[model samples]
Target chain A: MDQALPELNNPPKTRRGARTVRKLLDAAQEEFGSKGFHEASVAGITSAAGTAQGTFYIYFASKEELFRTLVFDLGRRLRDFLTENVDETTDRLTAEAQGMEAFIRFVRLYPDLYRIVLEAQFVDPEAFRLYFQDFGAAYRARCEAAATRGEIRVQDADAESWALMGISLFLGLRYGIWEAERDPGPVVASVMDMIANGLKPRPGEGGTA
Target chain B: MDQALPELNNPPKTRRGARTVRKLLDAAQEEFGSKGFHEASVAGITSAAGTAQGTFYIYFASKEELFRTLVFDLGRRLRDFLTENVDETTDRLTAEAQGMEAFIRFVRLYPDLYRIVLEAQFVDPEAFRLYFQDFGAAYRARCEAAATRGEIRVQDADAESWALMGISLFLGLRYGIWEAERDPGPVVASVMDMIANGLKPRPGEGGTA
Candidate 1:
């Protein structure tokens, strides 16, 4: 309980107040997700939360603050979600396959996640940069750890981290956001094939070589 | 000049007029790149181009139209840039390495390119969608051709194209935009190594296995 949460920099003092803040966030997500940050109003958020407008001001100063807060909050939520979704298997390649598929599924579930994040570039470029920077930093650490444990090959884990994140991101943009309307199972499998085995055609693996 | 160009859908009739259009576009790039779409003004663009305010209306209907056009125009330029930079080498790996390094360099040179493209998502979602969609389709065709020619492995070229694009994109973001203050040579080299050899540790590689 004593642990400081940056997402909630202005911590709610009471347990009931914490719950109210949670309610506001949930309502804010849907509101901004549907209406976007520019069109989304604090009044709309409070209304959605079933709280009075004054109550909204009690916790936050303006809509801008809430949107930025929601970005970090969503970022944390996504990190936790992916960690939970990835298989517990020791093999990094296998985990990547599960992790990417799970990421796409997350985008589908949280349709507004991309919209909100993308809009952050326009609203607050710093927040947008930090979002990816934090994610990339954490991911790089994991890749390095996995490389040490021999779960993955020895490689430039920093570039690999960004590269892998890029793969998941574009796939999410295509399949999850664009409503690709195609089965991701084969798509993910194909990506895993490239990730697990290099793109160079092997002699016995259906290659003319 | 007879051939139609979508970015300049409203083509200037004479060579002189065409030059003016080019000037406006180039100036717009700097303007939007510096000011962003929302903050950017048509007057600012005209001022940058050294054209009269009335001349601005000769080609573009509004600032919005110019921004959209700039997005597509930039997309074309990037495609040309990457195509020109990728080596004539037959090996897919060689081409990829050359292509990725070139892509990163392009980002460094055209610092506003990513910002303009990202802003397109907010200004015109359809344009942003088409920008990547068109790129993915072209990239997929090339991947399939490379696979058929045995230049690369045969996998899901569709997913592979998106994955590759994602890699170049995020790398561009990290190295080009964020001012990493590090040479991209090593970053891109590491990615090339991963692309050439899978992440799995091999006997000869420095892995303890």
Candidate 2:
């Protein structure tokens, strides 16, 4: 994962170097998430990482660069996490349900993920755009493949992908972040019901008694 | 609208005062939108508003106060806009479609809305929470009402409202902000189809036939 990030000037070649980069990134998340882009400092990040200040300069060039890199890294980590959770499911709808659950779980573990990504829109708009654009493209491809295989309804793949993304994003914001005490089971079931049955009442189906 | 915002230290009493307050907010949107929170200044807003610097003090206490006020103001304006657009429709699904279209149009007019609200997540966490919380509560109520009237399928109103909100929010981000040139007709159609029909293929339905 350390080598995958192009923002690092010196890609970690050794296991020890990779560990240092990971530490720095983790610490940067805390600093940036808490203090935001303007107030966050390299010294704060280095102290949080428990590494010497000089070690920070070994990888990232500046605070802005580090932020941009972190945005990409978070997006990659999230995608990897979702893929790992959902890839085994053969059905698209089932995979989507699993992916949605995985997303909320990931957000629970990394509450800072939303803060960093939302901050990217201000600190680095291009990075923010790329983050969603990259995700949207990949999501569209999956939807297209699923439609081709008769796993889901055939529709406009791009629009469907964005709609699905929006559903997950808002659900994560509401259930995963805002109301942490609420069990996500009911929330996930409600959303999946909509995904499978939509909001329109079927011709023969009656309202709940 | 002026009286609705509690963030203002002194609400405008007269038509002229209300207009002045409106000018300040409009200018504040431009300043904050272009330069963000920290870099934005009272002088900048006043200059943009074509009003004296002292006039800003009459309505707002500080830059932070103005920002918090702006966040609430944007949310209210958006809700009002959606309400006005959606009220005439008799069917819930039709109302939803119209509301989604109005939202995109609103975002196009106020491109800075997303920026300001997203910034509130960092600037004033409480205000940010209130903004979405208020919207979610109202949306859930409407969905519940519609469900009771048999205007839509029976489901969890809170979850359904959030999912619908998510669809509109993401679609607004994609078609409204990112790719402004794209015609929203097709995009809205695609989403309404998804809302009207689930992603699952029916028993006798053919794929894209």
Candidate 3:
């Protein structure tokens, strides 16, 4: 956090400054969501937030910086939501059910932010690359820990984590938000069932649970 | 397909016209891949293709139209690549392995067009939606047919097709295209295995071999 940076002169410790920051973030979210990263402007965000252009600059450096912050904030919320809502049980079926439920809730709650993050992946490849790399690495570590405890048999924990993440993102996009014309729950369940069962391999290669 | 005002007034049956069109398509692929749909301009593409700007519009209605053609062209090629390269077998595991292998090879070969399509989904939502709707519906029908023949058990074939599409796209982006590179083959195999086995609900749930 840039604590030393002041609003023109000194650090903005006043109530007005804090309010301004919140409004800017709220505004940025709307602009970025609706207009996209390349098309969005600082002026548009500031106007939406009901602040002057100068005030916008005083709080954030540029449109890119603000959008980056917005992505970071949204990513945090998604991670937290997934972690908090799902039960910590190691059972695959229970975990799948709870995980899918929480993810569905999150997708329904913040559809635009979800789209923004996904769009950002294409609109701004550099940023998307950085975020996913960090996300994948962090996620892989957690999955590896679980696999170590025999919670899951991950032939390659990193690859499994990436695939699981792929399942989460694509299922959410195709059903929940992308078209906004379909119910995603049933589909979510089917895929979840697939994940729960393990895609059928050779006969007699099945696991005993 | 539309021949009313062939961009190349001269018949592409002529070797020169064929060469020009090929050059233009190649140029559009390069520019669109690097700059995306919105950023790349007609002039840039034409310049890259070593053709005049008027000639660019002469062959295509606009940059978007050219990009659309490129997408259609590339997508068809990808489909062809998948079918041709993936050696089919009666068994599920062999089919999956071959499919993943072909997919990995395709990504490595045409990363540019791959990113363009992926980015188009985000950059131009309406265009992608309209374009993919029919494509998705057709793909869903194929899956449904496969399920009917007892090749796979799918509750919602459309959703499963979409899920598979999503999985493949994300896997390509994360493993092959995105930064901090990792080999895509092993990752693809691992995920495909998980999709085939890890997600199955129970014995006999997937259907008898």
Candidate 4:
């Protein structure tokens, strides 16, 4: 979490500076969300922010760094939501549905930011790689713990981690983003149910369903 | 599937034009793979091909057109691979594995083109929407046939189609390209197994390896 950059200097001494920083970040979210890392220009962010060119450089070192900040902010929010939404009292199916709901909300709220982050996998993979590993590690730890408690099978912790993350992502990317118009709730429910209790037939229950 | 683009007009007097086109596509594959769609320029592709800028324009109208050509080429290959690999003799497991194999091989073969197609999802969604839809339709049709034959349970057809595609994509993006040095065969097999038979426990089988 430690960084070399000056950390906002604790709540911007001037109201104007605070407004400028907020504007720049908001502009950055839109620019980076739409244009991605390389195509998004410094001028684009500054112009959208309604700030001078010099003012833009004062807050962030480069467009890449600014985009990183925006993406990291979004990632942190998703992680926070995931952590806070954990319901220890519920069964696996119910808990998973809640988790899906939380994730769907996050995706719907920031579709552009979500695309930016997802697209970063192809754009500047190194940035996302470092961040993904850190984020994936935390997610894996939670899933492994749940498995340890006999909630799920402790089969290949890392593989399970990948699958869980992959499933959640695919469902979101395909239905939530690609379709855009389709309501993601029912699809989310179907996927979560599939993950919790898989597609295979159960004893005494025919495979009709 | 018909298009209005010029194709082999007046027939090539010599292999010279064919050779030039091949070099251009190869150059595009490299440039688009490494830098992605928006970041990759016409100059870059042409320069890589050792041809002039004018020649590049002669073959493709714009970068989007060039990208669509690449996607169509890859899609055709993937479609062929899927069809050739899956037959009545192939069970659910083999078919899934072959599909995964085809996906991994395609990524390895055209890493840059792969990035371009993926990056297009964020960079130019409208321009490339139909390309993805066409490919998705092809894949869904295959999955649908497999389901109707009672090979697998008829789950959400759309979700299953997209999930399989997304899993292959995110896995290749995350593991195939990003990871330092990973043999994707085993991981791909694990995912195929997961997809063919979901993660629920069988009645008689225990967690012991």
TM-score per candidate for chain A alone: 0.88, 0.90, 0.81, 0.83
lDDT of 3 by residue, A17-122 (tens): 8767767777777788777777888888888888899887776777777777777777777777878877766555567567766776687778868867877766
Q: Measured against the native two-chain assembly using Cα atoms, what DockQ does each of the candidate structures obtain, in the order listed?
A: 0.55, 0.66, 0.35, 0.36
User: Which stretches of candidate 3 lie above 4 Å from their native place?
Assistant: A1-12, A90-92, A179-182, A201-209, B1-15, B130-142, B145-151, B179-183, B199-209
In candidate 4 chain B, what residue range of length 10 has the lowest lDDT sum?
B1-10
For candidate 2, write residues A92-192 as lDDT tens digits.
88888888888888878787877799778888989999998899999888777777777777568788789999998888887778887788877888888
Stretches of candidate 4 above 4 Å error?
A: A1-19, A84-93, A201-208, B1-15, B82-88, B201-209
lDDT by residue (B69-149, candidate 4, tens digit) is 776666666666667755636755467667776666666665666676766676567645766678778767766676555
Q: Give the candidates in order of lDDT, highest first.
A: 2, 1, 3, 4
TM-scores, all models, native as reference: 0.91, 0.93, 0.83, 0.84
Q: Write the per-residue lDDT of candidate 1 for residues A1-209, one digit (tens) a residue.
A: 22223355577788777777888888888988887676788888888888899888878888888888989987877878888998755577888888899889989988887778878977888999999989989888877777777777746787888999999988998888886577899989988788877787776655322
Ranked by TM-score from best down, the candidates are 2, 1, 4, 3
Ranking by DockQ: 2, 1, 4, 3
Number of residue pairs clashing in candidate 1, backbone atoms closer than 3 angstroms, sequence gap of 3 or more or interchain: 0
- Which window of 10 residues has the lowest lDDT sum in candidate 1 chain B? B1-10
Summarize candidate 2's per-residue lDDT along B1-209 as a digit string, tens digits. 34344346798888888888988888898889888998999999999888998888988889999999899889988978887777644877888889888888888888787779878878898998898889889888877777777777856778878888899888888887888778787888877887878788778775442
What local lDDT score does residue B154 receive in model 2, on the 0 to 100 scale? 54
lDDT of each: 0.81, 0.82, 0.67, 0.66
Docking class of 1: medium
lDDT for A50 (candidate 2): 84
User: Candidate 4's error at A53, in angstroms?
Assistant: 3.0
Provide the DockQ value for model 1. 0.55
